[model samples]
Target: MGLFTRLDRASVLYNGMADRLGVGETQRIDQPAGAAAYRSALLRCSACAEAEACAGWQMEHARADAAPGYCRNRGALAALRVE
Candidate 1:
């Protein structure tokens, strides 16, 4: 894939996972720490190898309690979810 397409895929995965985990709302409530964690999660997503599977999974599920096992950002996303 081209550079832009690859970057877009990564962005989609990061944003989709963030939304699924309510990271934006969390960041709004806990600015510094939440934003830092979310950014770190996004960085991890950008380097992940499961983009195709991640996209398919995100499309199939509107929300999930935890990210798929193959996701590089799974731990970060799961931790960010509100209890």
Candidate 2:
């Protein structure tokens, strides 16, 4: 994960804290390229060839009006294809 990326326990905890504090940006993965890199590293073991598709799906799914600046995939970056 990137320095700004949160996952598993950190993600859950951060989300909870952010909600309570009304500080959504604190837990957001606003840098899409960075977030995509982190996610690629994290899920590298998976044999799925649909990483880019999955990334796009996540971006669309996480869309919200509250924090338009906050994106789950940072800059809406596409995932790298596994060789």
| Winner by TM-score | 1
Give the least accurate 10-residue stretch of model 1, judged by summed lDDT.
23-32
Clashing pairs in 1: none
Query: Clashing pairs in model 2?
Result: 30-74, 31-74, 32-73, 32-74, 32-75
Compose the digit string of candidate 1's lDDT tens values, residues 1-83. Answer: 77667667777788887787666655533745766665666667777788878889989988777888898877766666667
Clash count, candidate 1:
0
Ten consecutive residues with minimal summed lDDT in candidate 2? Answer: 74-83
In model 2, state the lDDT of residue 49: 43
Candidate 1's C-alpha runs over 4 A off are 2-4, 25-39
**lDDT per residue (tens digit) for residues 1-83 in model 2:** 44344335334432433343343442335535646644553343133344445445435544322322333322322222111
Q: Candidate 2 local accuracy as lDDT?
A: 0.37
